[model samples]
Target chain A: MDNEMNYRKSLNKSTNKKVIRIGSQNYVVNAERFKEFKKNVIAITVSVALAIATFGYVKDNIKFHHEKVDISLEVYDQMVDKGYKPVPADGEWDYRYELLDGIDPFDLSIYMGSEDALSILQYRGYESWDDYAQQEGYKNQRDWYNAQKKKVINPETKSKGGK
Target chain B: MKPLAVGEMLTLGDEVEYVVMSRLNHNNKDYILFANIDNPEDIVVRIEKFENNELCLMGLENSDEFDSVLKLFGDQINNSL
Candidate 1:
């Protein structure tokens, strides 16, 4: 309390001027008017600080309310039955899948003939099938390719490879 | 056969093109979530199995299996947010 009083005293002493200068003209400063002005400024600052704190609290409360509602198994079944699919929030699609120990079973950079795919493989430092297969924990290129092939169902190439 | 990357669209036996939304590998089994191209809301979740190197989408016949997958997917989305 003593420290706060001293601080306020210092502030007042610094701001309270005896004379006001207006374009080379000196006028007597009104102490009452100066005090009122300072009071208003302080009030406005407090009000703004309070408003910001309240906003943050309300936003957190709303987020907590949303998290409280757990989707039960029955509710999930009903949603699927009604043809409503689970949709992730924007920019959060990457969280939908867990790439089993950093090994992506769906990564087709090895099989794609496109330059874009080749660039991706090169970017990953894989110069040959041997490098890719070894890095991917496969014994060889054929084994890795065979394992990955079993996960894909391409209708366009179905008749060609008995897929 | 080659690995079909996620987000790729392909026609099925019904001749309806569907978009592969995502894949979830849980409990030693792989599952795929897909949606009809025309109506994305019309979605389906199926067990992805390879028999004799042939990929097949099998319907979730067991209710418990379906429930667990649904819960796992729901929890993941919630936690991500």
Candidate 2:
């Protein structure tokens, strides 16, 4: 008890020294400044950690995006090769086949010299042979030409129109 | 064919005539889907084009190439239908 009293007395006498022994450092500490400094350090550490995590997440997402785009491009190219065309996003649309223009399918005169012209007429010539065939009542243009060989129905050609 | 725009008439060695339904180019090669102007079954032939405006149709001998082309054509055809 006497020793404890002596130590307490010494501590009281050393009040003017105004120094705290913290770990191995004998220094005066300002409680308010220490608290503020500790708060700033914690805040900085958390912000850096969050920043690193966010960067990693963003990088992963970008890689995934690139891979998705690459796959889509590959699929699109394959579709094009297979004759797939993209539909218009918005406009007048219909389910029926619309005739945009007429395709002059070989202009039958080109096949006049063909050996199989008679055979083709005997086979494929029909009401739906083409735009010209539908307009005219000619299933066999070759037969029509043969029938009108002497007569001139079309003044432009001085012969019957084959197509 | 009404739907296909290829209007050129192709005469074969057998003196049979055919019309093109569609054509595809892949890996520096051309493939044609044609049907006899008479008998209507579709036939596929590989083709080589020369500067002389001549197109030589070759029978597809490689089973793998033929199968690939057939599958690709079949997908598009089915989708269109």
Candidate 3:
């Protein structure tokens, strides 16, 4: 009976030693450090995704605007072809300068052409001469052209017309 | 096509402000002429000298009216004095 008890005690001591060795070798990783690493990775991924989305949106908007301007130009040309007459100012004028406010100059010039005076008159649908001149840019261009008209003379005699 | 007379007034379409002048020929028999718009500067052009036709243009200062004017009036210039 004494021998059996001593054997059982020895067995228990060996099992406890194994359990301690296993627990020491396999350590649990630091939960706080792991969480911080995951957060940084997520932040970087979100930033990159946002940047790509922004770039795409900007590019698409520019393309859409350009196409819209192009379509507008085509419509204007069609209107002109349909017997739309330009309403002239009071007197004969020379070069008319129409100022386009709050618009892209290059794009406006391309689609509308350089004759801003005529374009405005056509756009406004003014039938009579007086109604057309009342527009802001129309009056300005007409006035400027009128001032310059006196200088134009016959190339041969360099004299003003008798009429 | 006949050459543009001295007193003839050719109205360039809505975009431009110029009249066709008399037609002359270049070295290649291409019809060309002097034009005067509202500006004092005399512009040389090649145009068809029609009696009462209007030519539409885009820009007054920098226009391809000269070329179009030439093509349209080249034949008329050949017939002019």
What is the RMSD of candidate 1? Answer: 32.0
Model 2 is docked with a DockQ of 0.01
Best by lDDT: 1
Report iRMS values in order: 35.4, 47.0, 46.7
lDDT of 2: 0.39
lDDT of 1 at A52: 28
The stretch of ten residues in a row with the least summed lDDT in candidate 3 chain A is: A16-25
lDDT of each: 0.43, 0.39, 0.35
**Can you give the lDDT of residue B77 in candidate 1?**
34
lDDT of 3 by residue, A103-157 (tens): 3322333345435545545454654333443442334434433322222211233
TM-score of chain A of each: 0.25, 0.31, 0.29
* DockQ (0 to 1) for model 3: 0.00
lDDT of 2 by residue, B21-78 (tens): 4567777766665544443322434544442343334555454455456455544444
Interface RMSD, prediction 2: 47.0
Clashing residue pairs, backbone N/CA/C < 3 A, model 3: B1-B75, B1-B76, B2-B76, B13-B55, B46-B69, B46-B70, B47-B69, B47-B73, B48-B72, B48-B73
lDDT of 2 by residue, A1-163 (tens): 3333432332232222322111212122446534443455434333333332333334334444564465445544543454543232354221211221121222222222233222333344433334334345455545443433323222244444543
Q: Write the per-residue lDDT of candidate 3 for residues B1-81, one digit (tens) a residue.
A: 343344344433223223333444444333334333333122433323233342211121222333333334434433442
